[model samples]
Target: MPRVGLFIPCYIDQFYPDVGLATLEVLEQHGCEVDYPAAQTCCGQPMANTGCTDAAVPLAERMINVFAPYDYVVAPSGSCVAMVREHYTDLLPLTNKLQEFQAKTFELCEFLTDVLKVDSISGSFPYKVGVHQSCHGLRELRLARSSETVGDDFDKARQLLKSLDGISFAELTRTDECCGFGGTFAVHEEAVSCMMGRDRLADHRAAGTEVLTAGDMSCLMHLNGLNQRHAQPFPVMHIAQILAGRQPEGITPVNSTDGSVA
Candidate 1:
């Protein structure tokens, strides 16, 4: 078992802490000796993405040092993991340790599939789950094959999710479309972001999706917001929560819907 340091992204920490906890649960189930670094904070993806690399430098450095002692640093977010892997070189003077840290930082599904060699998951989530392949995960982490690429297609997240008994996958019209939550892109272009998000929501709803799940909570966060704004929210959960034996049926508002027309 690898000694893993959990990297909970800022959004997950403040807004969706349960996702962070669920990620911890999933990691532990697979025999990871998990430790959450209380010192761990934002990895500065927002700042870096917005061309403020200088502002992101200190935060990126903090993450590197905080998780340096662990054998592996695992995060539930592919976008955040992509930040450490793809963007950190611009933010810091690269040391050998920084290089190694970049290589070893695995998204939760990647850790389960690539690191732990997890093919068969032990759980049951019998619902039509609509898969959202966020940009960072699809392109950066290569968690799933991008639609534009030429190759035998693959989806690491779907592979893990399907391993659960009785899980039915919703056939999305556009499988790998962006959910309009490009970190700072959403903040800068709110109207466009919400429009794109609603499009995603409509696709999922049309597919008769029982629950929507994705490897990256940020994508789900954007879609979930649209679901709410339309006054017909379904249960939107992280893939970690589903894999860890949690169900959307257990939600307080019964899928966060208010008995209104969508």
Candidate 2:
């Protein structure tokens, strides 16, 4: 079994702790010796995305130092893993340490499918789900084929979800469109951000999905906020939560006006 370092994002740690717990549980069940460094915090994505490299450097160094010794470092968020794998080079001086850290970091689904060669999971998610392909996960990590790209395609998230019992995927019109929750982009450009989120939700609504699942909770947080604001029926969930067979707290099935599950 590999010694795994679980990198729970700062937002996940502070707000959606259940996602972190689900990630830990799922990895441990797969025969991994998982470790969580409580001192871990943000990967400095918010700061670095806003062009504040000065503020992000310390966080990057802290991350590398803490997880560098582990056999493998995995995170539930594709965006966070992208930060370490792609952006750490720009934030830190070019050295073997930086390259070593980047090489070992992986997104949870990628590690499961690519590294562990896991074809199926021991969980059941009996619901119609719409997959929201966050930008970093689709493009940076190549977890799924982008609709914009031309080639034979595959979807890692879809691959894992299909292995679960009684799980059906919704037919999304824009299969790989951005959910528009680009970390700081949401706060700085609220109007555009909300518009893109609304458009993404419309795609999910058209597919008649009962739940929205994605690799990144930040995208889900933005999308779910819009769902509640508009009184949409579906709930947003992390892929980890679904694969771990953990129902999110307070997520009841959407009911029709006549008080029946829709």
Candidate 3:
């Protein structure tokens, strides 16, 4: 078993603790010796996204310091992992630590599909969901590549969801595109971001998708907020929670559920 360090991003840790929990459960179930370094943080995504490399250095240093010895640094968020894998090296030029850490870090889906070779998961959910590809996860990470058709083309989210007993999913028209929730880009370019989100929502509504799922809450929050604002009936969810066999609509982890629960 490999020693794994789970790096939950600041936003996910603060607002969506359940995503972290689900990631923990899934990793543990899959035989990884996972440990959470509480001091771990933002992965400097906000600063890096804002082009503030100077401000991000300390956070990058802190993260590298905490998880330096781990065999692998894993996170459920692609953007953050991409920051570590792709941008941190460029941003934190003074430190060899960022480069080393980036090499070791793996986005949850990438680890599952590439390292874990996971054909399926032990958990499941029963719902009609449309997957929203966080731009970084799908493109920056090359997560859903059709070129590498060696295995099931099993995206981590799709693979995990398929493990459920009665879950049925609806595929969206555009599988991998931006959800218009580009971190602070939404705030800076509000009109364009909203328009992009509206386009995404239109596809979800067309699919009659009950829950829109994605790896990043940033995207989900954007889509969900728009859903709420426009009085759209559908909801959004993180793939981690769905894979951990947790249900929405007031379903907590304490509930013991089995059978084809559609």
Question: lDDT per model, in order?
Answer: 0.87, 0.88, 0.78
The TM-scores of all predictions, comma-separated, are 0.93, 0.93, 0.87
lDDT, residue 64, model 3: 86
The TM-score ranking, best first, is 2, 1, 3
Q: Write the per-residue lDDT of candidate 3 for residues 1-262, one digit (tens) a residue.
A: 9999999988888888999999998888888999998777677889878888889889888888999879999998888888878877676664566667777899887787789888777644555678887778776787775432455564666765676665666777876657788989999999999999989998888876777788887888888888888754565778877777777773322222453424
Candidate 2: Cα lDDT at 101: 90
lDDT of 2 by residue, 46-109 (tens): 9999999999999999999998779999999999999999899898899998999999999999
Tens-digit per-residue lDDT, 1-262, candidate 1: 7999999988888899988899899888889899998998899998898998889999998998999999999999999999999889988888898899998899999999999999988876767789899899889999988889999978998898888766788898988888998988899999999989988989999998878999888899888888877766788999988888887853332222344321
Please give the lDDT score at residue 165 for candidate 1: 67
TM-score, candidate number 3: 0.87
Model 3: which residue pairs collide? Answer: none
Stretches > 4 Å off in candidate 2 = 248-262
Error of 1 at 113 (Å): 0.3
Backbone Cα, N, C clashes tallied per candidate? 0, 0, 0
Alpha-carbon runs more than 4 Å astray in model 3: 94-97, 146-154, 250-262
Between prediction 2 and prediction 3, which has the larger lDDT?
2
